[model samples]
Target: MAFIFESDLKAFLFCLLQFVIAIVVSYSFSNYTNPEQRKLEKVAMLELKVEQTEKDIEQLRDLTRSLEGKYQNIESVHVPLVAFHVYNPLHTNLEVGQVIVYQTVPLNEGNGYDRKTGIFTTPVTGLYQFSAHICNQDNAMFVYAIVLEGETIALSTQRDMPSSCNTVNALTVASAGQQVSVQGVHMSKSYQVIENPHRKNSFNGVLLHRT
Candidate 1:
């Protein structure tokens, strides 16, 4: 009976050792990760980086376009407004071949006009529009002309008409400091430009377009 109990004890100790070894192997295997799952995680990280890089490139392109627009605006030319209008309220006429000095100035932008000299000096080099209104009385024939630097550019003729008015216009390209004026011209004898209570002579100029 003692010999039988000794053999049973040895078999029980061997079985317990085998069970502990199997549990340790299973726990180690459960902790191990698959190689395919690691590769998939790396690929997902690369995809996120590529998406962020694409967004950065798009933002850079937008900034380039904005800079290009501002550069174009900087290269463009800027034009200014220049204009003047003057007229004499005196009830008397001006002398023939004499510059009409309009004393009462309603508008004189740029301060380029001189009322004492009856000249409108150009403030800038640009295209200019000039106009004049001439009035006469007592059936006196008179011719008026818009002069630029001693050259006539426009004219209006009154042929023996009593209390008549005529309007003349001139479009010219003028340089800075050039003078513009209205004068009576092409008359056999000296005549007067009429300005009375019934009529008023006017001279005006404006910068139509800048070049």
Candidate 2:
């Protein structure tokens, strides 16, 4: 009886050892067999993480600037006084020489932009940067001109289907009360058409350096 019991225990121990060996072999085949592939995957993942981190940092910086513009008075620091962001949800139809008016004004520091006139008048003499974004309706095309002091500095166009949006930015020197706006160009050409209401067509400006 004692011999039979010992024989049964040895058989059980042998089976256990075989099971452990099989598990270890399977693990090695899945992981260690393709070391280069695993290394490449790790590298790709790291690069993607780094790229996303950079974008997050940039977005945070932009938010910080926007917040500073919101809370701080223009005179609080000598940094800058003129800054604004405005968008339009009205007046999609347009004609030649018509100015684009953005009715909504979210950030207007130093009272530089007029939501009524669709123009930005500088509050302080400095170098200014202006941006205009246009969105065309599904079956139309619209062209816009970024006018600084009544001179076209930049132009952009958007079409109905394939390309539905475009943007134009301008950098110019101006003084207090100098006008900056977007206008129709008669096709140089430009004529405004109905714009997509779902898209936010925008005009924004910022004072870069004080002269």
Best by lDDT: 1
Residue 65 lDDT in candidate 2: 96
The digit string of per-residue lDDT tens for model 1 on 1-211 reads 8888998888898899899999998877766655667889999999999999999999999999999999877644345668888886343444567777789888998898898888899988889999998776556777889999999999988865556888999999999889999887755434455666777789999987666
Q: Each candidate's TM vs. the true structure? A: 0.61, 0.57
- In model 2, pairs of residues that clash are 186-190, 187-190
Candidate 1 positional error at 50, Å: 26
Estimate, for each residue in 1-211, the C-alpha lDDT of model 2 and write its tens digit: 9999999999999999999999999998878768978889999999999999999999999999998887765544365667899886457667877887888888999887777788888887888888888876664666779898888889976665643677888888888778888887653213344445556788888988877
Off by over 4 Å in 1: 1-76, 89-96, 188-191
Q: What C-alpha root-mean-square deviation, in Å, does candidate 2 show against the real structure?
A: 24.0
Largest TM-score belongs to which candidate? 1
Worst 10 residues of 1 by lDDT: 88-97
Give me the overall lDDT of model 2.
Answer: 0.79
| Clashing residue pairs, backbone N/CA/C < 3 A, model 1 | none
Question: What's the true lDDT of residue 188 in model 2?
Answer: 24
